[model samples]
Target: MSVTRRVQNTVRALLGLTLAAVPGTAAAAAAPEADDSPTSASAGLRDPARKEIAMRLVSSAENSSLEWRKQYRYIEDIGDGRGYTAGIIGFCSGTGDMLELVEHYSSAKPGNVLEKYLPALRKVNGSDSHRGLGSAFVRDWEKAADDRDFREAQDHERDRVYFDPAVRRAQQDGLGALGQFVYYDAMVMHGAGGPDGFDAIRRAALEKAASPARGGDQGTYLNAFLDVRRKTMKREAAHEDTSRIDTAQRDFVRAGNFDLRTPLTWKVYGDGYRVD
Candidate 1:
């Protein structure tokens, strides 16, 4: 395990936190005791309406479309070296999540179209190599997208691998809907364990500001996190466009929209988007 991984494990163990991953991101140790306060701030991303908003917000950046459901069949390599970025959350073929999604799909419905590609998916698990899977695999993936089971599998894997952990950690940190969505977006874009992954970024942000659970200002802490995320995104060519933070999430933070109220407007890659 990396130094960041070790520290994260110790932190989670101490806090009794079950988060994003066995290979997931890390969270700050300070968890606010559950607050049932009937306030917008207490409403989290798990709330159905809020969750839908979160989905649209992320889709604006990830798929360049607010119609996130349309992206279940989306697949292609955007040259990030992560290989086929697909589905609603941009699950990369090079990354483990895509493989895991296929595995989950295969398990849930055996002999699924995607099940046959498990070996190829496993082979390219960590690095970008399309040795065994080429156009045929891509076509099959699009075909599989038409299956309701495949769609559910994508949703399930997304929640298990990214959404659930992110929302849980953000809620624990006393962040409202916006913060929870911010964490979820970061977790989706950056995986859990690497140096530039979500866990490391979270750890870096915590170094600069205490989470709201620790009594720090919510906006201040979120700014710290976004600043760190922006820097991390800038360091990579594929993620060089930081508008997801500068124009979207940062705008929300600057406007004091911690509850992430609707009629929201933002841009990603200079394209305008709105959720009202």
Candidate 2:
């Protein structure tokens, strides 16, 4: 067997999530079509309007509001152990993404307000220690957020580190607009490594159902993917809220709205939101 197959089998066994009812496997299936139709491929999250809807959907969960642009200055430690979850995509201080965001920002605009905090951000990397960052750092971050350049940097980094990759992977898997958005949301939250990360969740879902790329039913695969995501969130105290899955994505799947047509309504954290 190939190295990829070996890894998938190992993860499937470790996750113990084999779904016997789902048909086919990566080895047994033909490669998925590049586009289900002309409209589907171009109309996925790559479209500007659809991407805006995705932003609102993610913001509903991340900031508890659909006003994603307002979150450029948002910052706080939610006690998630990642430390200082901030910005539109919730880059964490404990995780390396926040540090990278600052690095990117500094590279773009020299002597920016947040440049001084780089040393502190690096020192606090991998743990929730605020040894070098405190209220002053928060102040500087908020100040930096006001800059148009800084906000643009956050958007660039967000697309670079999360959104673009997720959308590409989803399209490659022959997913539609909704599936593309689903992948983007998962990438925003879980990222792409470790046991509870986006990659692992996808692997577990694959063990239960083949993706559309692998000649599987799109709805079945998406439901399986959401099941893995929900279970993963429940495993963590900070990410235990499954309403994003229970009410939003699953609602879309159940409705067979694979194209993710707008005029949609959903609730997150018990707050209703609409994108028309």
TM for every model, in the order presented, reads: 0.84, 0.85
The collision pairs in model 1 are: 21-24
Q: How close is candidate 2 to the true structure, as a TM-score?
A: 0.85
Per-candidate local distance difference test: 0.76, 0.76
Tens digit of lDDT per residue, candidate 2, span 155-261?
99899999999989898889998899999899888888888888898899989999999999999999999998998888876677787788788888877778777
lDDT for each residue of candidate 1 in 206-248, tens digit (9 for 90 to 100): 9999999999999999999999998998897767778778877
User: In order, how many clashes per candidate?
Assistant: 1, 0
Off by over 4 Å in 2: 1-41
Positional deviation of 14 in candidate 2, in angstroms? 45
